[model samples]
Target: MADRRSAGSRSIAIVGPYLSGKTTLLESLLSVTGATTRKGSIKEHNTIGDASAEARDRQMTVEVNSATVEYEGLRWNFLDCPGSIELAQETYNALIGVDAVVVVCEPVVDRVLNLSPLFNFLDEWEIPHLIFLNKMDRADVDFMQVLHALAAVSSRPLIPHQYPIGHGHKLKGFIDLVTEDAFQYHSGACADPIPFPEELQVEEKSARQEMLETLADFDDKLLEELLEDIPPPQDEILQDLKMELGADLIVPVFFGVAEEDYGVRPLMEALLREAPDPSATAERRGLNDADNQPIAQVLKTYYTPQGGKLSLVRVWQGQIEDGMTLNDVRVGGMYRLMGQQHQSVLRAGAGELVALARMDQVKTGDVLTAHAPAPDLPVARMIPQVYAKAIEADNRKDEVKLTSVLGKLLEEDPGLRWEQQGDTHEIVLWGQGDIHLQVALSRLQRKYNLPMTTHQPKIPYRESIRRTTSVHGRYKHQTGGHGQFGDVFLDIQPRERGAGFQFTQKIVGGVVPKQYIPGVEAGVRDYLARGPMGFPVVDIAVTLTNGSYHSVDSSEQAFKQAARIAMQEGMPRCKPVLLEPILNIKIAVPNDFTSKILRLVSGRRGQILGYDAKAAWSGWDEVVAQLPQAEMHDLIVELRSLTLGVGSFEWTYDHLQEVPERFTTQVLQAAWNTK
Candidate 1:
């Protein structure tokens, strides 16, 4: 396939659960195809996709890595996407510009269950995909059982193109039912055809017939021939597989041990011949005309040390040039993404993903289609589920530097957010979780040399009144020449929970000068802003009634002082309460772990809504719940523990509820001391 064929080369995202051999498969693909000098083992920490220090230390694919291989004159870019749901966006982002996905799964039933999330993502996106059953050598499970497990959540027919030649630990390789041949792992790089073992020949023949029957159902003529006892031609089987996959009606399953590279050759051949190319894909996005208008999407961004932010884009229409201005948009610097590095390229075409340098205002999902009338594409949205606050050195001079350092760090990761928490003088840095926040903070120190300290963020608790009462506040200072005198009477009452603070004036006789009333209200507000507890006071209504003032010496300051004193006298008597934040969370884990999960929920004072089967999960279930934000820190740790390091979740702010009495004491005490 020529680069300009435009119906871009078929791409497949190799994704699944963590430690399920996603990176190992990538290493295998690169080695068998001779893309690299030698395959780097994870144990040696030298694989391409698992390049980061943290990733190597953990022996996992933390981010998606795309690698290109030229096979049989057609270029195939396989996206080695991370299997962890925590870094799912890395997979989602890769899926955006590809033709199809190849979901890699393990042989164990529990491990196979984790494939749901990837399944759902592909199904929801209508991405034509195939499921690769990897690591056959480590399992004791039946092959059909694994197929049935996948088919349980699969809406489309999970037709198999190949089957394992043996079961469990004795499994050596696969029987390509389509080819009716046995593939043995002569080396850890590829499958080599060999004589079938006499003992398994009968089983292999039955599987080959079953696969042929599956392929027949996809074609009208073949289906008729199959029913009529006519053998379908090899060409017909290949054509039917291509049709079903292209129509997104079926997900073909390919069995392989990626670590041994047992079945990659056949998998690669299927991808090149059966998977639809870029032209068919882009057409669905309404990209047809050469002059229709230029349309591209910013899929991801990276900052270049010399040129600045690199915006990786997938152009769907009209061509981009070196200097041409499409509408008001100027041609930004163009570069080709070579793994993590970028090299300047003259131009990249429609259906091609390219990295353009230094496009600052562009973000992750910005669409640049038809410059004049932008085509409305559904926005690719990712919610940052977890959050933790990061703080700076907390020293006087370092505070200013921290602010400056954070400003630049934020440019790279929009999921990273921060707030000054102004009055408290605490710079709160928020992110998806502890690791996410720390990663940004680490970059600040290592990449930008900005040293900082951080702590688990304090909840922004607010205080309000449950009842109202009236009180008087007076301040008199008689030193000499001009004596100070001021007095105020107030009627305080409760407002709706979120209504916030409100003040009203009702002066019947102007007992206190009308000019001095403004000062009195200001004084009342000053007390409310800091509150009886050291937090913003809300849901309270105050009415200014009768008061006295010295005609000559009572200044605005004196009236303000009197009002402040009056509020201080009345607030404590009104039955003040504290409010805390509640977050709605959704945790997905294996189905077997459900009972224990609910138990853990109760321990955290959390309310579990329900347990529902989620197809996108591999060997798991998802539980939706609502828990107080204050109790969230160790929830992920507990979730992993309960599921044996297989479960994960995402959360967001739900609402606010009154803090229970047991928790209110601490809230009020902290507030009083701060006041």
Candidate 2:
């Protein structure tokens, strides 16, 4: 908890594919760092990083989590992000405040390909990072072979910082390429600093040469020294390594069987010595008001037992004092976070990540600078791909709670969304995928004790006439002194596809009075909003050719009746047809699965728009197609099932295509019965 302990401290996010021991690695790091007295197991459902019931049930990380550890006199804030692509955006958000990222990868060739998205993101953001080859104890395959596989998938140079000394369950230890020291595993637990093994001297020298050459890539002085058979100073090499790391030119690679805790100490040393600190990142990210104004960005927000809405904010400028009103915006509360338990700090300075609690309208990605109405910060945004129709609380007792829960979820994850689906009166929650929305639901249940049920959204379909017909309708009723009476004549014709609904008038003489005529058109328009087939009427033009109405009895109501009667009589003769929504889908899959993916697309009655291999990924292909949205409601499930969870797709409504004749009739019958 000392200030100096976290002086050079850097936040590092552990990201990789699913079931790659991410939770176990987090627990191990906690145990080794002395944050926890005993390391917890994922199967036992006691890991610090996975505290939610859904996570325990799944036995895998379902959301992003943050934890801090102090070791070797420096604090480390490690963010263990979920591995599955379903929660990748959460991981990317975690990457925002952190100075560097540690891409935890499995020591297998095939599984390593799954890190493409993460790798691509790191490159896009130009974030300094490293390769952490985990599960070395169980890694029966060759380490260099795995590196070769990584080289094919990774765009950055994966300079080896360490190499395993052995293999399989007998993976005794690793040889540090930088220090030329050998470390042995005691029992997949906390490691002890030890002397190098004499037998590994040959490998140590060779690996050290590779490390030296990697460092010399950006240092001409070192390159000249190496070429002239002269040795460069160790301190100079360290400086260059740190410099290049900050510039995003080098990604230090670290090898460790996290379960064994074999290489953690050295990994920590590298992080402290090489990874950029808050000061360096502050200079790069730039302070908006570096001179006179206070500026900070709220990167994360969480609830605390007594702290009350702790916002984990990174100070980009002036100090965040305990009791200061930047612009009378908020009477700032305590600055504290859960360090094992809630710990308070009076103030946090520039480049420091701290928690600000009970601040009004202070949210994730908000620019908390000096102002009453804060200038909104540009934050990360992701498109939602999955959707589900929901209903208000069945008990009608949780409406407020559900609203609060939804607000919290949207704040935490920028990818989630909720809306009142106008067509079906269903409250729908849309997001990245099923797992993403499910995790949110679990978070709602655990955080707010709210229960919710989600069903597939009702597909928005349209019905249009294929043929034209004219019909007249009349309505008359006598109740009192005044009697209601109205008549309307409609000439309906098909328009070009996607022309939607149009209304016009062709009456030269007022067969129907002017006021009554507008009412008739209004009634016709209302009917078109929801057609007889229980869908919106589209691509049809309607005209009021002739009509009759009683001056006293004619009203919007009477004209509405006439229009309704006309539609009932005219629609059946107009060749009604059911139109299904078409979706433009872009599916990414491994090249080996291309044939299967194409077959599935074809089976869905899809039209191939384009197909090409991904330039960023090896052995991967992208298939662009347009298919019926109805067929794509569960397409993600099927794609994952077919491709072993290695495929992903983004799709949205493109256009409507006519349903098959038999299906159209069935749809019409279903709508008739349901209505």
- Top candidate, metric TM-score: 2
> Taking the tens digit of each residue's C-alpha lDDT, what string does model 1 give over 1-675?
564244544556788887778888887877777777788788987777777654675677755565665566655666677676556665676676677778888877766556665666676777888887888776576888888888876767787888777777777777767667777765565567888778878777776677667766666788788789887777878888888887778989987777777777777778877887776667755567656476777766665456677766777666666554543556677765535655566765655667666565666667775356666665445645465664777355766677666766665555567887755667777665565665666676666666677666677777788887999999998886997888999999988866777888898877888888889889988998777666678788889989877788898889999999998989999987777778888887878889999999878879899888865554467899999877887677678767755567778787767888987887667656654
Off by over 4 Å in 2: 1-8, 70-73, 188-206, 231-233, 288-293, 304-308, 326-328, 371-378, 387-392, 589-595, 613-621, 642-646, 665-675
Clashes of 1: 21
Cα lDDT, model 2, residue 99:
80
- What's model 1's TM-score? 0.88
lDDT of 2 by residue, 500-617 (tens): 7788888767777777776777778878877767788889988988887777887878887888788878887998887888988889887888889998999988888888997766
TM-score for candidate 2, please give it.
Answer: 0.91
RMSD of 1: 3.6
Please give the distance, in angstroms, between residue 663's alpha carbon in candidate 1 and its true position after superposition.
Answer: 2.9
Pick by lDDT: which candidate is best? 2
Give the local distance difference test score of model 2: 0.74
